[model samples]
Target: MKMTPHENTKQFPALAPGPPRMFAPQTSTAVSRPKKNSTACLACKAAKRKCSGPDAPCKACRSTNTECHFDPSRDLRRKVAVKRTIQELTNHKDLLESLLSTLGSADQLQFDKVMDLIRKKAPFQDIAHAVGSPATTFGDPQELSNASKLAILEYGENHIETSGNGVRRPSDPGNIASSPEEIPNMKPPQWPTVSPYARVTLESLCDIPLFEVPAKPWTKVTDDDYLVSHLVSLYFTWDHPCTQFLDQRIFLQHMKLGDRRSEFCTPLLVNSLLSMASTYSDSPDVFSTPENVFSRGQNFFHEAQKLWEVEDDDHDLPNIQALLLMCCVFKCQGRVKKSWMMLSQAVRLAQDIGLFDTPAVSKKKMLPEMERVRTITAWGVFNMSSQMSIELQKIAPLEYPTSDVKLCGNEDFDWTPYPRSNKITYDKKPARLPEVREGLAELTRTLVDVQNLVSEKRRGTNLDELWRKAQDPFDRLTAWLQRWPSVPEIQPNPVPQVLLLRIKCLQAIIHLFEILNDPHQPQSVRQARFYQVKSVEETAQCLRIHRQSYGLKHIPSQIVDAIQTGLRILVPQLEESDESRQAFAELCRFGTALSHRFMQTADVIHEIRKNALHLGVRLPPEVIAIFDDPEQWRSLEP
Candidate 1:
């Protein structure tokens, strides 16, 4: 249609081809993101100013004419990498210590040399800084030897003592290093395989019912109601004497098939309950081997502890009870440090709920149905915390000067009143439970006061006041025991309860004379002899009661401690007579029974047998079997 190219060009001779247009892609909205505060350049951060980016000639750096650079912490990859390194090092340190016990002296020396080489050449300085242990404290090889460094790593600062030549010593209770607060602060490391927060949400956990009704079919735990009922009954009966935390009727009602809450059931609560009940439950087949039963979940207590949300459990009773029960499990397992830490938390939690208040104040707020149970739980914690501090020689739970939480009575409802005309003196007829529980509360408080004074390792207080304060509790306890059987609770099955109180009283007496009795003070030797003899008689009586009636329900640390104290006192007297030898033999047998779970007590007995055979006190044959090998304690199960 166009004329020939030339002909067309002639018609529009001045026209020429224009430049071609090209197609371009459109920009995307998908890649857009909100602006974030950029990490400041190191120089800018030092000057307290902002940075545009870590680029060459960044805005601030350009303005200040300084080179732009990133802070070491600003590298996300490095931060995570370093944290993992710290955790790995910490874990390795623990693993090495545990394995060292299995190694021979020669092997240990070889391991020490290897550790020394590693510390000198490895990147420990950087790792130490990363974990918050200052490099200056750990950097120089001369400053800390490999052994010292390992001690610091394994137990943290508070668990070891440093000698002048850089050797390490086990922490002594007399030294301030072994403070009670040490264990409370040391936390087990978290690993990826065990996330306590797994499968459990924190948002509604504390406020929600402890057992939420499942909306679907239940399957995680067994649906065997018979087992559940039996376990529930076992726990209440065994534990109720001490804490009385759960109201049996209310708990049973809540656990009914139609009324049950499943979603709220926590693994630790159920596992701890089962574990504790297994220790006392009558089902022989299920609990034939306690070690097998307790170790079921393989570090279940640790797992349960990980799930304990201390910050959120201020007002939650069930979780608090679970915490206390976990403490019992630890105590039963001879894990003293863990038990004390758990008890500390339980006490603090009780404080948060104002359960430490004296009876007068708590009564004003408590519901009538809940009054007796709550009061008993609070007082139980107080009783436990006070005794633990005494035994451990630590500063105790801080409470209001005056007692506020009330004691429990037989009624399980309110404190029963006495006739106004009746004189409630101890020498008179047996007092009702209200009066007896009051005495028990007083005894606990008084003993705590005695411990604080006697355990004063460094204080320059007068010896006379300490002695007087210590004797006051003994006098009061003696008077209380004289009148104690009048109470209905003590009257029916009084041997076990009386022996418990008597053993505790004996412990206080032993601690008084053995620890704080001044070597040079006038008549100190004579007074100590009297107290020592008294403790021996009491311990024998307590053991006699256990054998005759209750048999034994898991020997407690107090019993172990009392027996050890008797052994210590009797050591000097063994050369004096055959009577002293008889007393010594009895104590050795007790030490054997107690050492079944608590190996430290066995170690004490072994040391006595090893170093003090010249004392002429022969250990029993059964004890010698165990001393030959501590592992044989399992054979003493029956």
Candidate 2:
């Protein structure tokens, strides 16, 4: 019998006793799949042999004496393929999460181990095989995980909804769970309602991440604890919330109760309260009456003073300065007696601290506060004098009658002499009229004294002080203008304008006399006096022009009323005069040309305030003209 294929193989000595296994002839498919050759260094593309490109002097090239240049394109292609494999592996979020969960459960998780696991599970057979067999795999699992998280986070942010629809589906499936809509809207778990400790913790969390805090079904953090406490303080201290809940009194009380004793207390909050009180004092409706606000403001000032007495050295000094400013603001709104008392205290404090005697401690710091104080002082004086003038008019009808005495050619302008029986003899002693004249005279004298002191001190101080003193004369003169009519004329014949002019002339004359009398004064000082004389002459010319333009028949009781009726009507006609307009245009051009020269002089004066250079270079004639005619000043563009 013919031997069977297995039986024949078994019968042969080589086959032994084992059953014969049929062997197929080797084909292309029968051999194992050829592995990509990663070990073939990129430098040896044409050779089809291993190379040592990375190591210096590639062995093959050295042997052949050929230059061994790295084939960067080949290396780049390999690197790209490796990166593509890794990116695909990292993009599989479900696989990564599953692996993470498994490792977490085993308690054997490590970055390297996870990375190894990822390489084993990566989609590319090359990657899997390479990991198992060693030569061609790439990537780190930690790096891949980080990349995945970053991608998901970006997708979630970009897709968050503006409309009612919560979120759009993520373009990448790996980001599905990170969707805003998919995350459960679980309220932060509620703790007991009355627990302060829990509330503090919740508030801290809310403050740290304000945007993340939810607005939904009642959570442990009620808006009251999280929002109200902090916001109430901020709204009260800063200018926000846009609501007028508390007046000055109630607001101060609430702030004090909150134990909020920061710099926010005085200058920020209390000073704002003082400003409100002042505004309300002027208004009829808001706060109804400022009495309560004023009282509360005074208390706030005292409180701030106490705080300042013991404040830390490092705290802002400007805040304390602001407090003093508020005190001045409140005091100005008070009665004359009260204002006087407050001003006396303020001046004493200012002087004691050498605020006024020396250059301001820090000009940038203190100038605004000083200006505020000066403003309050000026306003108080104006109001007081105005009230006094009104009272005097009411009391002495013969002297300060509301109706004009008609000093024209009418019977009212009677030149009758007093009867000898009624006329008290001036030979032995003149009869004293009353306290009214004495009081007014004393007040006027005091004002003049103060004016002189300011003028004297101004010559030795800074530009700011000089400017302050310049304003003082104007203020005093204005007050005197209001009171001048009350005084009986010293001259036998007085033109109403002439009488007013005389008072101004006297003031100017006095100022001029003082400047001239000082023999040791510098030439610059003499030049300054010349400009000042020119200013006085211009003011006199304005008064004369005013009187002539009005063509008034008699002396009017109110100087302002007379000037208003006279000057305003004349202005348009005066402006229309070709000669006047030409003169004004020339003055404006001259002022524009000379601004640089004046600025230089101002800078020089600013530098040497109390020496030969203290007085600025004489003001130009055109600048002087502009001050005399404000309409001309307004016409010019800066």
Candidate 3:
């Protein structure tokens, strides 16, 4: 069969060598050919343009005035073959080098057939070089650069540097800039030192145990969300350090991006910052403080204020609650006007959003404290205005009271028969007096309305209603007091409005007692009235003291002075008549129980102010004179 295959190739040899016999090329036809133009030579295929062959410039290139030289190296027929052969040899060399680097002699032998095929195709010069030089030298510089880059990525700045200056060096050890320790020999900073009352740490303040798990288990002792909410609540409590965490750089770093935790924690964080700022503003120990803390706190408050204003609908309640806490801090710091404005805004927001009327069946229980705050604020305004009026009266006495008295009748009529009692009669009204009386009545009415609303079972109504009621009475009272007429009789009853108020209060108390005494009333009602009586009495006592302190003579000055002297006398006569004992008891029931302690504090303050006072007194001589005289000393004994 092998002989038959060879015999077939021999017999077919005729088909291989008869190409000289032509089918149609024997005839010589005189075909008219177009003349080739030397000025417009065909472009070379590789360069896509005409080229001058061997000559310095061809006719076409010279006509175009372009530089022209034939690329003698562009041998179309043989170029591809030469390039392919060189590429094949180079590729084989690279493959062998890769194999040798990764494997030993046995493995290298596996590529022997591939090496032999490459040797057969390669030129003699190439074969000699491949045998003489190892394949390792053929390693590409591009590969080296790529490997170096990968190493740099993994090891981070541990690299060697190759410079154009022919210097090969390791990267500077001190210049290792990838890690936190890049700054040489620097120790990590210690946690900031803080005062015991001032210092607040995240761990100490937060129940972070709740945040330990990814998913909140229904049966767990505490879950993450619940813990977070509780932490927020704690942060809002008075003087809590949870606020400090907001401004901490470390805390911010830990609050990872794309995390929902920060959104839930925002209200607490904002509130805490506001509180810290307020505390700094309010603290009395200014000498031992850092200025930056106060400034930082103020900045935080401003930032929080902006954030709170733009709160999303879902977070509106928490946001408002945070704002309310800020208002409280402002109030406590004596920034009354600012606090009132903030509180007004908060109340408006609560009403507009219907937060006050939120069903109790919802997650959060409605807080009664908000209504309580509003009531206290209203009272504060009233008290502040009243105090201011009293001060104005002291400094600038009303001229009408000090002016000469004129009779309305002629000399024949003796109009002095009826003695003036100095008391303004509420029953019979005068022209100017009615306005004052009406104003006082309006204030009383307003106070009653506020008291009633406050006493109701703590449902949030329109806070603006209470505020408007408060403002109307306050404005009227202020205007009336400021323009109060000064008659001769009025001077005797300096604060006629206050006197009238006292009388009305006493009447209310009497009515309340009557209600309590009624057998038809419920025991709870009676008990409530009893408490009301105590409160009213306490209020009356305070008003009495206030009037006395202002130098008003609605109650006789002699009676007030005697009472003060009698209190001192009764101190040693502790076992005096029940009446005297009752007087002492009454004084104690009022704020006078700590009068001695207050007096001591006052004496210290007075000592500081003595040099500043306009009037001078010989205190040492007076004291010595009093102590030197036995009778005077005996008289001073309690």
In order, the Cα lDDT scores of the candidates are 0.52, 0.34, 0.35
- lDDT by residue (tens digit), candidate 1, 11-103: 344477668778678764465686755566778778887667655567888877887777644433344434534544444453343234223
TM-score per candidate: 0.52, 0.19, 0.23
Q: Give me the displacement of residue 133 in model 3, in angstroms.
A: 84
On residues 162-230, what C-alpha lDDT tens digit does candidate 3 reach at each position? Answer: 467745456766533455575678564343433223534342343332112121211122234433333
Cα displacement (angstroms), candidate 1, residue 329, comes to 3.0
lDDT of 1 at 441: 72
Q: In order, what is each prediction's RMSD in angstroms?
A: 27.6, 34.4, 42.6
Candidate 1 accuracy as lDDT? 0.52
Ranked by TM-score, top first? 1, 3, 2
Q: Pairs clashing in candidate 2? A: none
Checking candidate 1 for backbone clashes, the offending pairs are 212-261, 212-262, 212-264, 357-404, 357-405, 358-404, 358-405, 359-404, 430-486
Tens digit of per-residue lDDT, candidate 2, span 524-552: 45554444443333333344332332222
Deviation in Å, model 3, residue 493 alpha carbon:
48
Question: Worst 10-residue stretch by lDDT in candidate 2?
Answer: 408-417
Residue-pair clashes, model 3: 3
Taking the candidates one at a time, how many backbone clashes does each contain? Answer: 9, 0, 3
